[model samples]
Target chain A: MKIALFGNPNTGKSSMFNLLTGLRQQVSNFPGVTIEKRIGTFKIGDQKHQLTDFPGTYSIYPHSLDEEIVSQVVTNPTHEDFPELAIVVVDSSNLERNMLLFTQLYDLKIPLVLVLNMWDIAEKNGIKIDISALEFLFPGTPIITMNARIGLGKERLFAAISTTNKAQELSPFYDGFFPSPIEDKDAQKQEIQDRYEKLRTILPSIQGKKSSVKSTFSRKLDAIIIHRFWGYFIFSAVLLIIFQFIFAFATLPMDWIEHLFITLSAWLSGALPDGVLNNLLTQGILPGIAGVLMFIPQIALLFFFIALLEESGYLSRVVFIMDRLMRPFGLNGKSIVPLMSSVACAIPGIMATRTISDWKERLITIIIAPLMSCSARIPVYTLLIALVIPKTYVFGFISLQGLVLFALYSLGLVAALLLALVLKKFIRSKNNGFLIMEMPEYKKPRWSNIMISITEKIKVFVWDAGKVILAISIILWVLAAYGPSDSMSSKIRAIKETSLYIKSTEPQKETMIASAKLEGSFIGITGKYIEPIISPLGYDWKIGISLISSFAAREVFVGSLSTIHAVHDENERHENLQTHLKEARRSDGTPVYSLATGASLMVFYVFAMQCMATLAVVKKETKSWRWPFIQLVIMGIMAYVGALITYLILT
Target chain B: MIQEIAVVLLLILSLAYLCYRLNRKFFSSGKGCDTCAFSEKGKIEHLN
Candidate 1:
């Protein structure tokens, strides 16, 4: 039998879903984490069933996009044809808001169940719910109290799900939006008051807490974290820690993944035999795909930290603190969440902008959100950082490489604010709506939710990005390896002959020298064509070609560079791209990667619209080729100017 | 095979574009900023 789970925002509805389905979605005690509808499947009693997990919403009233979906699903008359067995998950600690949805569902006369999730927290806070009283009040529906964090009382929930009626009617949920003044004003008021009084009566019996102390704990947590100055400091420290932790903690797993990918690529190369097909399948495709997947550990870890912050209710405080800071940028405080999310990827970051009610704020947030250095930037940043900053020692214990890495990230944020500020003045918008967010009660985040969230991130990063990257790399290999011209192969033959001649001069390094020279012959030519354009921005032909190819994804540049440099599919052969970068010389023997060039290229990528997928998404989101066109022009100019300045200053 | 795939992709893309154009010409002139908050422009007027 199919079951539908319903709950107010910030409720442990997701935890109950995870319990019932044995899966987790990143759960934050914070409001507004799950923006899109997430669906999963499970089997019960020899029957396969689908579980549709709607975005968390407070009420059935269509206020936000999430609420609209919830209202549509619950009130769909045709849902009667299917098993609309709704298990109303409630935060036992905060039942008043949950009751708003519960009362509406009850009126629909639908078969329902009450799950007092987070009962463990309720007990800790000295708040109690009489489950028996709840059962008596909502006679038809089963009332099951559960601590959704653990498996305690979960079987009861599933059993309740099994016995519930398939199709039950529900009443329309309402917030006290307006009061009727014409129809015997006194009588109408009396009627409304009576209904409220009736609800107020059973509500007290079901919930032991008085209305005076509701959200007191949350209020206390918010007081310190949302302080005008302290809150800002706390948020900065948290962001720094989270970011620094992603690099520090994920290093081991990242190394392991790197090793795994190299091994797999080697095995694939050998398994498929030495041919065009084999080279394409292994060297081109596998390594490119692996390049993306190798970063999955860091990506997952980043999400894990974000998930924890969200679940612990710290995220809302961030939104509250950032509101005043973001206002000057023509964005509201609500835009911070979306902007923060953009650091993960711009796709969800753009989607997260939907939470901002103000159209002006939303548009500005959406436009600048991509400027945040996403996980995609990690590969490029790592490459440049590897290629330029020597890890050995610079000034102090703090790795100079780390400082440069931090600056690159900070540059993305700086660019975002500047773009937002400019657009705030330039783009005429009508929306002036202010942010109104529910600050959820702070608690230790449930581990299951964090696990679920991190897993989903890993799954998507590997499955989605890996596939496309692999395909593009192989295509690039075809283009560079064969080219549309014969000069490519003949040029490589010429290089080979020269390398043999030089064998007597440098016998030990002949093999290495020959391979490097051949790379200059094939992909090098293509890079040279783009070299003139990129030279102004301080990029070499090699960096130019990688940047051009990485339009598909920035991460693929590492694989492209690795392949071009003739790095073997082995860990030992993977030279530090940074030292190689520093030592790299042109045919005329001048240094290839000067400080001016590296800084300029970095600045250019910061503002330039590089991701084709992002462009396609922007086209879809704005529902016009016009917005993307405007975006390309405006942001592209910003990129050019920014790169020009960086090159000038650094030189 | 890559050529075949590319050909099919181009065909499908153009076909979809044609359908989109036809739909826009016939259906409500394609929303014209259904959710836009800009009060200066007419509700039906499209943004460049």
Candidate 2:
């Protein structure tokens, strides 16, 4: 049987769905709308039923696309997801306001079980409910009081569902709820107002008096949280702390992961015989996998903080505050959520753009969303920052490295906004964007919800991003391992016969021959071909190769560099990537990763569209290749120009 | 010699598999990446 769970926003309906379904839930979009449809299954007495959790709405008469979905599905019997039974979840504390939608559903004659969710909060606010009175008023309908956060009232809800009849019979209270269909719009409004008047008259019998003190407290808190001036300050402070915590907490784990991979690589090299298999395992696969795994600590921490903000309801206030600022840039406040989400990763951030109603604004948000430095760029930023920026402190407290990292994040934000301003001028839209978000009341964040979010996000990063990195790494290994058949062998032979090779120690001789062979390899030739294009940015062919390989993922740059350098420099096999990069030099005897080169590379990563996953998601989200292709060209040009300017100024 | 030949064949098979997976992920209309939070149903739903 198909059951539908419907409710007003902030009624704890999703929480109840989570409790009922646990991990059996599947998320998809409703037909013709980007609004998410979450379905789950629960069995009662060996009979399994599908429950569809519809997006929250205020009434059957819809104002927004999200609400239109609910209106269409419930009113249209021919719809595929038309429910046999409807579960109308209501916020118990605000029953008068909540009953607006319930009355409509009741009049529609859909068989329903009323759920008085957040019952504990209602009771604490001094509101009393006469359960038997409610039962008497609405005959044949079961009312289940629940605190969905902790899985309370599950047994009773199940018992009610198991025994309830499936017939669509309206309660006696709703007999005259709908006045006869009116032709005029104003008449329809008058009828709705009359229904509310009748509901008010009936409210006294079933509901006891509630205090206004609790609501007043919420208002007073919002006064400061959503204040024009203090709101921005608090939001900035919260963001600063989140970034600081990520850097502080993730360092130990990141260091451990780095150390573990280095040791494993060394062990594999010692144990395996020298051959193609050994090189693939030790040089190509292990380092690539390690490169992906090393970023998990930071990624997990970022999602943890975001989940906390969302669960606490502060994320909505940020939307409220940012909406005003974003309007002049052609975006509404809803764009803030996706932009903030992009800080963790752009794929989900782009997916989150479904919440935005305007097409032009949403497309613009998707185009500029990736410019926000995601966690994928963290590896590149950390490596480059460590190389160029000294680890000294400013004002006796702030780390210089931390400040530079903050500047990179700020640059992405500023650039996204500026680009949005420019795109606003070109993309025409007649729809005026408005924010209709519900400010969910502040509460202690649920730890279980936070953990689920963190685990899911980290899993997505590792598996999705991991596959791309691994494939690219293997391809890179092949390109670097072999060269033109005879030329590579002859190059190695000639290097060994040189006076320098003959006079050198055993270790130096091996290093020279390895380096000589690499210079003749396929990747080496490809890198050289692109050297002229990248030379203006202070990059050699080696850096050029990394830049090309990293188009699969920005983080892959580090792995490719490590793989390429490890191919030749066996003595530095176990050395950390940072140390190896520091020691890398061009053929002209200049350090390859000088301050100019490091800064240029970091600038390029900040602006470049280097992630295939992000590009794929944009294509999927916009339902066209046009936007993603345009995004590629725009970001690529910006990266090149920015890198050129940075390198020129620094040198 | 046998070991070398086996390793060569294994490498070829691995590369082929990698290429196939890459094409499926980035090019074809399937859920390109399983780990992406966006549902495959959502991506393919609108296309049809």
- Highest DockQ against the true fold, candidate: 2
Which 10-residue window of candidate 2 chain A scores lowest in summed lDDT? A24-33
Give me the overall lDDT of model 1. 0.64
DockQ of predictions, in order shown: 0.04, 0.27
DockQ of 1: 0.04
Residues A41-160 of candidate 1: C-alpha lDDT, one tens digit per residue: 677688666665566665555545555566666666575323367778887777775676677666665578888887776776788777777776667688888987677897787688
What's the CA RMSD of model 1 in angstroms? 8.0
Error of 2 at A585 (Å): 1.2
Docking class of 2: acceptable
True contacts kept of each: 0.00, 0.14
Among all candidates shown, the one with the greatest TM-score: 2
| Count of clashes in candidate 1 | 11
lDDT value, residue A573 of candidate 1: 44
